[model samples]
Target: MTDAESPANGSGVGAVRSHLESTISGTLESRNAGAFVHAGSRHDPTVRYCRVALGRRWPRERGREVVAVAFDGDEWLTASSDDASGHPAETLAVRLAERSGSNTILTPAAVPHDAALYLERAGLDLASTDVVARARATKTTAERDRIADAQAAASAGIRRAASLLADAAIDDGRLAADGDPITPNRLRTTIDEAIVSAGAFPAGTTVVNPDPEHAPSTLDGEGTANDGDTSEVPLRPGEPIVLETAPRGPDGYHAGLVRTLVVDSDGGRERRAHVGATQSFRSAAAMLTADAESVTSVEADLEAEVRAFGFGEGDDVRTRAFGVGLEPCERPFEGGDRIDPGSVVRLESAVHVDDGSWLRIADLLVSSEDGERAAYLEAPSRSLEPSALLE
Candidate 1:
């Protein structure tokens, strides 16, 4: 890599959205969306593909999903409108499609009911497929670098957690620092502050409450750390501490990470779960190449690794992995979809050892086209030991 592209010397930040970065872009694939109108809010299932269809980023207001763009195979037509009475975006989209000599709207069946009425009233046929989502999942060079930057920021947060845990003391079978017991809330705050210090914004659910000593698992609502006082419990000694977070960079791209740690270990379930989790982590990551087949394959491999470690796939609560980018978990590779280069996916490997106790290790990975290797975006160590994490 050239010095100009080095992460330290040149931080490539702007790859997606800016300013009201909350205000994002509206886009739908025109390649296969021919003779169809593509319109939906960010809340739609297809809404996850809204920002990637066209090419670059545009502006989307916080609440209104009122932008529609259509390509008639020759020229481009763009229109946007807002109203309380009906779906103005859909109205404009259908009108533009008809103007382009087409009377059909190609959209996922998951589009909002109000928006669906616009196309149905126009007597246009609705195609029940998410062609826009299937069109492409590749990120440009700048976008990849931007995501890597966000991963770096997330790594900073993990480092902060590790540093704090390393400095804490085990007192009366509990983690303590500065004469006070180290709580999940304190660790989460430390991690979020580290992410912010590294020029990234912690999401509403940034740092999930880590697993304590006796009671291991505390994963809530896919990790809603900012929700209740679940993170107020003091950490236990010699148990798995799950430090998982997804933080967004200035460019509106997000990165995810999960690493477990055990303090003052007595070499019990913590060691066993960590060993299996680490192996599963590497095994799943190895399948993130451009030619990778499906997410199920990776998930199966991870499950096997943990199961081989003499653990059962804990009931309904288990581990999972998927694609990560603008949204924390977007464009999942389920349903036998092919992996494309330039796609960033997060493989979160969790091992449920017993009731209320689990161990997990996760990382952000970028696919490579050359078959050479996929690269990890975050640079934090996945050591289950605090001293190793300090390294």
Candidate 2:
């Protein structure tokens, strides 16, 4: 690091701020203003927000990632891993224009906007921002690799959650194993401990009742139960248990796992539903093995399987499967997102019974080059029974 770039000590935030302030230099003011515009947080200081954003995107190598800073009263684009010093802003502008062609390009609208300068340097004109965003959405193999690892950790967490509930029964405000009730707050603490033992972060955990009348509600991913529903209620025989967990690595890659269990009962009706749902999950898994299949295609197949299993169309199965990455869920499998060769997704297929009987199982799915051999991190059995563990 140069004298101008030396980081401050004491706290991580301080060091980050120092580095950003120095690295950005004259561009800091403009970048800070842009940060506010993007964040839409009037109370948040622009400089602090810029520092945080940069910290999140900090590349391992100083010059490997692309970054734009206001420089010489203009926005300058540079890649620490590649073009560290960067060309004149006008040159980069031209390049951006050429890459976009008919698409529109966007630049920072805040303090030190110089997108026009970079565009001119690249011998191109500024276009629409949408086009540039589209191009950047595509993932690389390296990123997919990280995402796959994250999913593996997340799957491990789900297994741990299953173990925690193996003998758990909730009574009143407390959860019980045999007859003794455990407090509602203890549930998270216990589950979280188990998750750590299983080798994954306790990103989030929720064990809630599935409501038919209000079943159409969406999961915020934070695991909150809808309305006044009480997940803290006593666990009764024949009631369903939903456990969703996600774990992230230090690298920011993440994965998710969702498992639904019914207390100690695997009767014909319950077993049938579980079997059918598990089969549906497997079918989707099978389809994901192929690289040629897109996320939408996989979702369609999963839905079809659910329907074929005798479930009515009115029963909303909720989300099919989605991409898992840095944000717990990322690209490729997000709704409306396409699956590319380098994408990593999580496969979830579920069946809900009228009496709040639900069965959901999730696994990390990696797209394969063959379009027929997608990989999975969670190898739990498709049966949903204890005997089906790791099959």
Candidate 3:
């Protein structure tokens, strides 16, 4: 996290202030701007917000207020409860608005519905939108560092899983490690452990799909193979195992990694699909630039390449390019939003083979300033060579 006392020049807060100044003529109000504390515990977003807003962590010195307002005609005002009146945040905000003679305040879209109603009842006009999301989409140098740390942890987890797959003993068409059979549950646990040990938070559960037909179609779905009894099905040669994970570091930034590997061989179709997916990912990533064309145009080019490589329409092949930061899927690189320099995004491609299996790969890339090419954040080799996993 960046120092709170330091100026947030060109940071998300600055971006948000610029947006509000241009859009609204009144003051802006925010509440619960930090994380909710329960039993002496708080989440990372709250901590990060506090670091950004106050240059400090939570448990904010009780009477010291964290709520801030950027008044249109005046400078920014940051206040805490002045007295022991025990006033709620909304009440204080209402009082501030009335005192300042401002009728409406712009809030972020994440504000709860009840909060909105309360603000409305207090005679404060509220304009809510994804302002915070927009601010977060473009990361600061500190935020990028945290994300890179998280991505390193995610890569460690992936390498651990690959090592397990490569070293497992294949006996009677079953995979065994350390004299015990390797199940999806066990593998997921191992990956989580590796991630946590590598300085990341504990990943609740990872998607380990040894069966292509049973893999979740979307990236967000839960992983359940062999009817949720993944141990019942052992590893088989020539079968694709999809291992996908999104792990967050202690600082609360997430990095996503997805790789599909085969125990022995992937047959000809899987190899072709892998090649196509790789091509699609590289093509799309190459087009990501600060002043590049529209996302739709880049996507069209990627789809065309995939189709030309034999994974055409109705083959269930999909490609997505989006930002990755505090959240795995931050603001999408879509809707005509020009790619901003320093924006970290992921290019993902998943292709379903004729044998009812899936081949997928994803990589992280960051757009560069003028005259510079986009850089790869996580440069793990995408080679499908089985020997690479063993090494």
- Please, what is the whole-model Cα lDDT of each candidate in the order they appear? 0.62, 0.48, 0.60
Candidate 2 structure lDDT: 0.48
Model 1, runs deviating above 4 Å = 1-33, 42-65, 82-87, 210-229, 288-290, 310-319
What would the per-residue lDDT of candidate 1 be over residues 307-391, giving only the tens digit for each residue? 7887764532256657776667766667465556767778766665544556778887777767768877757778777778657
Q: Write the residue-wise lDDT of candidate 2 on 243-338 in tens digits.
A: 566665444455566666655664755566666666666786566554456567788887777677666778757446666654555455546676
Model 3, 11-30: lDDT tens digits are 44544345434333322334
Question: Which TM-score value belongs to model 3?
Answer: 0.77
